[model samples]
Target: MSPPPAESGYSLVWSDDFSGAAGSLPNQSKWNIVSSGPNSGNQEVQHYTQSNSNSSLSGSGMLHITPQHNNGQWTSARLECKSSFQCPAGHRLLLQAELRSGTFPANQQSGIWPAFWALGNDIRNGNNVSWPQCGEWDIFENAHGADFSLGTLHYGRGGTDHLSKGSARQTFQVESFHTWAVKVNRSPSNWQDETLEWWLDGNKFFQVKGSDVGDGELWGRVAHKGFFPILNVAVGSNFPGGGQPDDKTTTGLGSGLQVKYVAAYKSN
Candidate 1:
């Protein structure tokens, strides 16, 4: 499938349409299969896996991150982009994706959570700077099989505690594809004045300026620093649900996270 067109003054920087033979793994050079404990450990019960059974190409230009339940364990998939992207000085950066919430009904999706988000590259590259300080930007997140989604920004002075800004809750077609995006604007004359905006299906729902953070230094670390993308389905945690997969939750594709594409654009 063709990638979505960039904004009039922007050009494509990187993208993946997930076009390939069905069941194949994602392109290795473009993504790293994360095999870990619930990705940052959110009290989630699923362990991300490297198996195609968990994450694979749909052969129809889509990527599927499915979660499976076994004899007594739950397993899922998580992928991190191999590159870090940022809004260049005097320009802007757009991170977007086309996603659908599987085909399952919200009520039966107990513990199901899917998201498209990013974390500061410092943490990805093991730069030694810990979380919160490194920053986190959540472009889209749906939990507990809810009918709505959320967007958020996380940053602070460097510790377990952090400051966060969340977008207004918005509902969308539960099982249909929709565009989710976040744009980082760096056109401000001053580095401390950059901003981040969140959009859902072309509608701007939230915007936050660096000044809103109150700490110029903290804002710079989140707004100006390079960040990489992440796609994963976690099964319950401190997230909204606060519950794990129950008997009501179905396993397999019906509860998976489907993505048509993931792309980044830089304003010309």
Candidate 2:
């Protein structure tokens, strides 16, 4: 994927254009298709699977993570990057994706959660660790098919005491492609003053500085460590207040999350 428009100084460090044959899974070397080991904590209702029915390539340059209802149960897919990524001390690291949600109204989309986010690389198998402690950056998050999207930072500790802040919700047209991105700019001489910016369709809507987090260690969890990208579409989860899909909820491809591309860049 090319760097965001006019960002000519950025060099592509990694990217996935989703150009595989129709119905194939994403490149295994670059991503892990999570089939299990989740849901217990999130209270999510959908069972994540590696089935093509849930995730596949469109052959026309797109990755589709479809959420479907079957036999009174729901299922979906999630893909996590295999490599840890971070911006260097004097540069910027940019993460961006072209994505669109399924067509449906807010009421019908209740309990549907689609996201493009990241977590610290420290979170791995057999490590037995909690989230946010490693830190998180939510580049794109939408719930209940809301007209707005949120960009949030999760730092400090985890659970009840976890520190969190979301950008002022920015309204957008859903069901159509939009570019969601986050730039971790390490331009400041002091790490505490560096900034994390959130952008949509080339327009920056919100930002937060390390000073805003107010803790060097906590800030370092996100700024100084490595993180990987995640793409998933969930249903009936904790984030949506435990709401479940009703008969009105659309299933199958109509409710899938379409991803045209995802890329990472480093500013030169």
Predicted model with the maximum lDDT? 1
- The residue ranges of model 2 lying beyond 4 angstroms of the native Cα positions read 1-6, 37-40, 125-129, 158-160, 240-242
- Residue 73, candidate 2: alpha-carbon lDDT: 86
Q: How accurate is candidate 2 locally (lDDT)?
A: 0.84
Per-residue lDDT of candidate 2, residues 190-216 (tens digit): 978899999999899999898899888
Number of the top TM-score candidate:
1
Query: Model 1, 139: alpha-carbon shift in Å?
Result: 0.5
Relative to the true structure, how large is the alpha-carbon lDDT of every model? Answer: 0.87, 0.84
**lDDT, residue 177, model 1:** 91
In model 1, state the lDDT of residue 111: 87
